[model samples]
Target: MARAQRPGSPPPGGLSVQDQAPGDRRRDSWKDSWGPARARLTDLAEDYARLLASQDPAAAEATGLPSRTLLPDVGPEALAERNRVERRLHQLVRAVETPRSLTGNHGAKDDDARDSTPGDGDPWGRAPLAVRVLRAHLLERLGTSIDLIESADQGAELNILTSPFQGVRRRLITLPTDLPGSTSSVQDWADLVDRYRAAPRALTGIRDSLAVSAAQGVLPPRGQVEAVARQTDDLARILASQARGDLSGGGHAAPGGALGRDLQVAANDAAQAVSDLGRYLRGELAPLTPVREGVGPSRHACWVRRMLGTSIDTAEVYQWARQELVDVVAAQDALAAEVLGTGSRAGDLDAHLRADPSTGMSPEDFPRWAQGVADEAWDAVVGRLLDVPDGLGRPTVLLDTPGGGVHYEEPEPSRSLSGRVLRSFAVGDETVWPWAERTTVLHESVPGHHTHSGAQSLDPSLTLWQRYLGKVPGCNEGWALYAERLAIETGLLSKPADRFGWLAARRWRIVRVLVDLGVHSWLPVPAEIAALPGAGGGTQWDRPTVEAALRAHTVLGEGFLQFEVDKQLGWPAQGLAYMLGERVWLAGRERAQHRAEEVRKKLDLRAFHNRGIGLGSVGLDLLIRELG
Candidate 1:
């Protein structure tokens, strides 16, 4: 039989299959088969079920995650199969429940709880496409199912004020299946509880403020409000359910059944409290207020700050980022002349980037153009770039406009629509900056998330949690930012303007770190710092000085400023990931590169990167050690 070409390989006319050697042909045949050459995919469905039964049987029953058998090995074939089953599982789960976190203890404490914060330029936060899809499944299956029933607070538009004592209840129980050797120390749980309790007063205050704003004509849409309430009710229920289940010793089979029962009651109590507050908003506060469309960034920031545990001074952080921006812009200016024809106007860069017409071009093409540039970058880096694995699959670039940013969804199981790189289209009228788009692709696709996540799946030795759970934002995103800079240093951005894009992206991260630290840490925002460049010259800001500082430093134009500020306001510590992740990544790389030099061997950049990613998603502190 005539040998075939790799499926993704540029086809016959341009790259002849017959001309290829036998070894290449053999590999291409495997790629062409559309199934992994090694594993028996048939066994995957059963193994997956076994794993789930061992880990979380109740969640398995609720979502059917345990029904499928996943292949045992961590080979490419096994991963491919795992991907397929996980995707189906996700679809089934999302159909049952939305993953949007409602305002409750857990959701309120974590800044990254919002649905919009996924893949926000962080490699770790960027769940593998399989994981992202599966997490949606996990959320739907293991998370709260509030949409099925109305929450008691569903119709209430009031902010319930409760005594701090009412919210200070505590319980300690050893959880069954806390993952073999899971180290959730008593102190950690105690700290989590303490943090949860510390915020009631602040949460109540923010709720009341938002209500006041709403009464004065500034409230989020009714649907959004109801959504928040439902989310809140659902989260409380989930927490309560988990607790109850732990007490019952149900193991994985009755996942969160105990929590469900406990939260069922908690939800009712909270609803009544909210309802009473709603009455106060409409009756006592309505007459004295001015109506508005939604709670703005200021109010949202307050809530986010209370949730995430942060202590960075926002004003100082903003000043630092702004200063860095000046330096970055200056550097870009020097490079622009050499790349964009020496005299290209400042306004021309965006248009120049969008003008590239390449092989994968589409009508008013967005991602294809970006992908082409990224492809060129990869070509430059391959072999010479780093130690890229031969088996790593080529990424599939797709538009995800209408969503905030690019997302790296790992491939589905069964290899159907696998490795689809979903790029959220410029949702709404958010203009796509050519440089921003390409940088995003590099970070989310190339030597960034796509590579990191793929490595995790391929590394069988990693624990399930490392492979799939607890992807705290800081390390993941930080690595991506580092990767972007690494690509630039490696001369991947041959085009000067592309280099500028990388720098711009870096500036974006600097901003995120400063702001994230500011909000969660309760640092003050300086008025002078607030007066720096941003929306309304920072006049629109009325947040804690720290939050205001972060916003002013990270965001530029009015709209971006507003969007990021609001995002940070609603979700704390999330912004910190971009900065913190990058910092750790940069420092670690520096250490690696320095150590490699003293050893007098050509440092394998690819191996270093793969190792970092292969360690799995871990806490930033652990990440530093893993890299070392």
Candidate 2:
């Protein structure tokens, strides 16, 4: 049997070495132009990337790094080591002088702008755009990481989504067996077996950290603990079933063979480990966790910085969200009236659309329909709206596992694998809503994550850290939300039903701001919002009250709505990223437009988009400055 080719090997019929030489030379020239300070930053970024890859195996696999077989060691010793490495990296970053060409006469005067917060330092003192963005990115990112670790926030992070328990199992289940080849080799199976065998140790490390957190009174809420425990139990069952299936005939390895048996035994062991974790969480940890879901003000602020890469005044943001929610609901009501030719209630409009045979699709047709939408979006945007690199091809659309939710997975940094838009549906979810899904496809594929992430991966000017690790949710999710609105502006959502879908999506995000802030920061629910049916009469926000609010304002299915609520409760401040990020994007664009008009020039939308995305993922604060 032929051995699997390494990742990053040219795909069949892809560009040959000669064909790629010109682009390669161009990239080299770009790198050669960097000054010593920039060069030092790039070197540090590479070092950090390697360190992260060694510590985070799931991340390594996601980014096509070499260490895909290992799992993260989240024990106290490992956490301390990581903190030390981050501190040293931070020191080196601070010591590197700004290039004189980049830092004009401003002389790095510290300013207390919203972009610059305490301990984050300032990155906006007359430096060239590139220098300022890079410096700010490193400062904000490293600062946030160090803060989370030091504050014990890292140890207490258990959630429905993005927690270590879920991440380990998800990564294992989704591990790419056919990497660098069309079919798995025996070696590939062996590698997977190795990961399964290592699962117990990795999970033990996580449990140790969580135990420490519990002792320190830094535990996640009881709800999150319970949810994760249930999820772990489900995952254990899936793993066990998977093992038996593989041993019988479901996998590439021969039945009753040594490799097959090894896989079965390893997978069973991993399942048992997961089962043990579930029991521990439910029996020992849940009772100790706080009943109230909120993380309170101080921890909420830390999470805001971690998720958005900027600090926000929670009260101010909450007030803004209240008014924004009002405005969005008004707009949504008008759209509903236009779409249904009746009342302005969103539920009625959604019901009408869902009941319409023309608007519904069978589950079998969902992927193809979604794919067409993605392809059409590509054709509509490229060249006309934005300058897409020839190498950053269209993303593939597929149905993911049940309950996975809709998301975009970035391509392997090497570009050997294309990005994917995974659309998940709950079991028995047979009907697909095109009107709603069209905006989603546009957000996750064409002008959203795939476009942003693919461009970053393909850019030779980016450091490895920027390409693989520089994920600011504010910049990333904000751009996607902006893309949704852009689609409406550009006529992609021209149909009345589709346009209403956009409004529904917009309203959903706006509602998220209120719900996230209300629950996490303990903001009092506004009077008007509290009056809505199902929204319980209380100043405080709770799961039932928030669920009622989501029901009234958004068109999501029950399962997804519950999932979203749980996600917000468990992962504080993350749901705020969409609306808050969009706020910055819109403000940035308007500022650019105003400046262009002042110069008596029309702003070129294509260039504006390409240039902004070309900077790769940075904090919203850095994003606005860089765009200007």
User: Highest lDDT among the candidates is held by which one?
Assistant: 2
Residue-level lDDT of model 2, residues 390-460, one tens digit each, is: 56788989877687378888776354778888888888887888888899899999888878876777666
Per-residue accuracy of model 1 over 442-550 as CA lDDT, tens digit each: 7876667766665554444433433444354565666677777767777665566667677666666665555544443434333555665442333333344334555
Local accuracy by lDDT, each model? 0.46, 0.77
Q: Per-residue error at 289 for model 1, in Å?
A: 16
Q: 79 in model 2: Cα distance from truth in Å?
A: 1.3
**RMSD in angstroms between candidate 1 and the native structure over all alpha carbons:** 19.6
RMSD of 2: 7.3
Structure candidate 2, residue pairs in collision: none
